[model samples]
Target chain A: MMETTTSLSFTEDGFEAFAAGREEPQWLSDLRNAAWKKFSELPWPARNDEEWIRTDIRQFKLDRYSLALEPLTSEATATALMRDGVELGGGCTSFDGRKVDSFLKDKWAEKGVVFGSFGDVIRSHGDLIQPYLLRRAVNPNYDKFAALHTAFMTGGTILYIPRGIVVDEPFHALSTLSNGSADFGHTLVILEDGAEATMLSETASEDVDGGGLHCGAIELVLNPGAHLRYVNLQNWGSNVWHFAHQKAVVDRDASLQWTIAAMGAKVAKVNQHVGLIGEGANCQVNGVMFTEGKQHLSYHTLQHHEAPNCRSDFLYKAGLQDKSRTVWRGMIKVDPIAQRTDGYQRNDNLLLSAAARADSIPGLEIEADDVRCTHGSTSGRVDDELIFYAQCRGYTRKEAIQMIVTGFFQKVFDRISIESVREALGLAIARRVREYE
Target chain B: MIDTLVIRDLHVSVEGKPILRGVTLTMNRGETHAMMGPNGSGKSTLGLAIMGHPNYEVTEGSIELNGEDLVEMSPDQRARAGMFLAFQRPIAIPGVKLADFLRHATTNVRRPDRKEGEELIPMRDFRKELKGNMEQLQMDVEFARRYVNDGFSGGEMKRAEILQLAMLQPKFAILDETDSGLDADAVRLASESIAEIGREKMGLLIITHHDKLLVHNPPEFTHVMLGGRLVETGGIELANELHSEGYDRIRKAYPEADAQNQAMLEKEDAQPVG
Candidate 1:
């Protein structure tokens, strides 16, 4: 089956056999081939690159990583500890790039809400999925990793809320990877005019020793008058190297509330961009990351206001302990047509140990004269006064520091409207904080 | 016998400059002592040093709690050993819910004898006791929802401090200038709460620069501090003496303390930040 190579590297014949064995559609094969061509042409991120300045990913040796290449082979275990779908709502669990379990409430299904496996949706709603697959959001050629993900994309999930349909239920998806395996998954969400829903997606590496790869992409589109709340929780284990490219486009009068929690992975680099493309559109993007013990995490975010009267806000907060380090680069861009646009972006970092380090770079690019745009970044140590107060209450220094760090992230956590996701993410953050202790 | 906190000839410093020097004092269980002086007389330093603030170095002397040396104990260790300090300026921790903070604190301090690293008090008991204490302090039940001192008024911060004292129920509490920023009503409430906590159950070290807060709950010992020295020890009448005469006579008598004040004013008159 040519499932592997001598050096655990990817080769042309192996990839062709891998794709053809899966019987992927011809167009998908062509798309993947083109993506691979682009990936081969581009260069690895350089030290002088503006976005790559604070983060150096030279240690990521892609050739050494191996893909499972087989879908649920014998003895394959679904290692993901699945979270329950909210009562009456529905969720799907994916094991090593294949859908495992999926369910949706009857009422929402009755309302024409399409929640299905990525492949199933592509075949069933082919017309609706074709045009916006990777064209409207998450451009494949944006970077080296984006093209790599597109070239090797295996499995994914899609949520489509039909026009005028208001889905009160949440649709969740979890992608799990086994040790010595790689998963290239994609997520796509489309809300037509006046459609509203929440999409919560999470990824984790199954507990095992050998290193793995969790590379993926996300595409979200909100039609005029549509409102969507999207959340992405990334908590791959210490041996996993995670990379993702996520982008969203909000139309006129539409709103997108996007929250991301990055708390795991040995090293992770992600690019998240949101575009307020229509007048009166609004978007709020938030991120929380807790890293410890030599973990290196980086996030590059862009909030683009392309139309007049659009509003955008982005806040990224991180807490680093032990020898962990984090880099956050957030940019807000206002177009010339975006008159009276309101844009704000901030990145805050708290260092829990002297060995921990954080770099926050907030930038604003305003091409419009009448726009109100601002950006700020701050990195500071924990306040001793706060710790002393907590100590006087009998809490150990660790607990006091944990309380302060939790408070720092709680501001972002509470904005996550989904109770289960909020709680699960909070627990994940707490667990990460306790990892050092 | 309950517990006692004895501070003997204590010397303290911040950033290599001395703040409190050769200050000796003691208060056994069921006793209230007020240490009063003008601003920058190191009254707060004494409270902080007793609480073992890391930066407030105890350069000399010993602080013993029930015969155990507190000078070497971490603040949390001292707290677990039944010490409390109501900061004149309580720090605001945004997003840390009041209920959660109170619960952890109540559990830790209340169960000092619990094995190290043991689970905290049950959430049920913690919530019930917190409700009762908040009610007693006239704190809004919603105070449980808000962050600790985050966006709270000056008076609310003061009340929150007392709330900790009442719930943690420490055997020794030092109120560092507890009456500085309170309104008349809040000051009255704070004094009443302190009085209710009482000297018999706990030793109280009230550090203040004014006698207004002392009126409601008079101290058994009123010690005047000048230039970080314990200059006088008398009844509450000494408070009245200073309240009327102000620090003029005392400042005149303690020329060295007055010289320290002059240097501070001159420093301020120069470039403050520089």
Candidate 2:
């Protein structure tokens, strides 16, 4: 494979070159320029920051990775776990921030549904996507990573469902990263009133031990009475540095079920938020994480009830082995006007080794008198008696532990309606379980 | 050829404390033996030791299954070698369905050489056999869908154990107070189920304090265990005698073992319960 690095160094000159390469609308270019200015002005997150307290990034140097402007002529190798044995309404694959292959069924496309590469869709349907692009769900100036992603974001996926069109088949999007490369991919999904769809988006590296950088964002916009089931799997090699900003906004009577699973990355810091913007909006969030070696993953989540009569449920479960550590901080915030709001959040961690550690912090802030909000967190090791009982039933010691770990995550898996997602996650986790005495 | 499990002067301990000083027993396939003892007499300790419970350390003697020493093997290996123990207080495994657990277990026990991740028993055949056994035990079809032992009442737990005993079909099976905490009807159902499962097919070791469990499956040999040792061995009449009169006569006849049993009971009382 040839190693061709672009002269894009995340500087002013590089940003200008990147924007010039794409003949996008002047409005989009203006958004990128403004974001680039913010990216250059904002400082890197300090260790004392609340979200970065447990996530150390001193070892992460942006200079070690460079943006790849040209797509690799040779095919990059990566596994797509969520695409097994399912016909799709649309599918897109990107490598090193460039579109490699993408296809959308004509039936859905003819029905006023737009799905394709982000770069292509933004050009063709600029007027349709301008209002929701970094304008509503996600704030590009939230942090340094968010600003950088908006400024240099390249090949990703965009899905738009017109009013009252419900797509039965799921849309698939996969982003593959090569060793020592950087991926600034952005995913945007827009659902109009009464529109419904399911989107499965995942990230993978060419090698399990490869190194890369992924600073991305996901914005999900659900209009009135719209429903969306979004599944995101982050399986980027063990040596990647991942930082992401993901959020979803639900309008009146709309509902969202989002499942996020992360099993890779040397160090990952993610901020996930959900906003109930209109009355009677409901959202359910399920998070599953498995880490090993010296990996560290920290997730800060917020369930914000901005409107009255909204409901939100969040559950996150993580399994850690070796010297890996996971930090989960969740909050449920209900505004004063959000009367009759119902919010629930829980985090559970299962430690598989003596050295492994998990920090769970669950908080609730309710200003509404007629609302109910509850949160709970737990961290414990696998019980020896459970292993012994399974062993007595003819499972090997390692197999028993694996089964118990799988059982530990079964609660979240049960909440997932996708069968292939469950099986793929189960097998992936089982393969990583090592025999511990 | 007949299978045999012979325990010769076995000694076991828990957390550096000796529980079973010296216990010896022998049983061939198609035989039933009743072991009657009071609490802390090391009855359950013996059952756990035979199945290689990690906490039960064997300090002396040997447990042989068909001329093979089991002390060196893991619990799963002992299970694969045709041995089963129905725990008195079975632990709950949440999120693992009973049917799935048994399917993996049955596949491994039947194919002793099977490795982890190997194909389990076919769902069709396994479900059919499980349905038959569950019906014989008078269990509801929904019981198979529940998590293993999770939130089960005492009677339900005992019935689940019997269902496992019926499915595994081990060569030597130990029933560790399997009838305790059960009402009269539940005990009778459990006793009849055990008899139907093990009567001419497997060797049975029934550990209990009451006669309800021994009603349908009369023991061919009755042994009195005091202070971790068998003081006397008799026939079915002995089990009836103990049930009717209690252990007053045996305690008086065996004063030394009785004293040791009292001391162990006091020590047990001082410790916190799990």
Per-model RMSD to reference: 3.6, 1.6
Summarize candidate 2's per-residue lDDT along B116-234 as a digit string, tens digits.
88899899999999999999999998999999999999999999999998889999999988999999899999999999999879999999999988999999999899988899999
TM score of chain A per candidate: 0.93, 0.98
lDDT of 2 by residue, A277-353 (tens): 99999999999999999999999999999999999999999999999999999999999999999999999999999
Candidate 1, CAPRI quality class derived from DockQ: medium
Alpha-carbon deviation at A189 in model 1, angstroms: 1.7
lDDT (C-alpha, whole model) for all candidates? 0.81, 0.91
Q: What are the per-residue Cα lDDT tens digits for candidate 1 across B1-274?
A: 6677788999887767677778888888777888888766777778888888887888899999889999998898899998999988889998899988888888888777655347888889888888888888888899889999999988889888888888888888888878878888888888888788655577888888777678767888888887778878888888888778888888888898767655544443221111
TM-score, structure 1 vs. true: 0.90
Q: Candidate 1 lDDT, tens digit per residue, A368-424?
A: 999988888889888877888888788887788778888988888777777776777
TM-score winner among the candidates?
2
CA deviation > 4 Å runs, candidate 1: A1-9, A74-85, A104-111, A123-127, A208-210, A434-437, B16-18, B114-139, B183-185, B199-201, B245-274
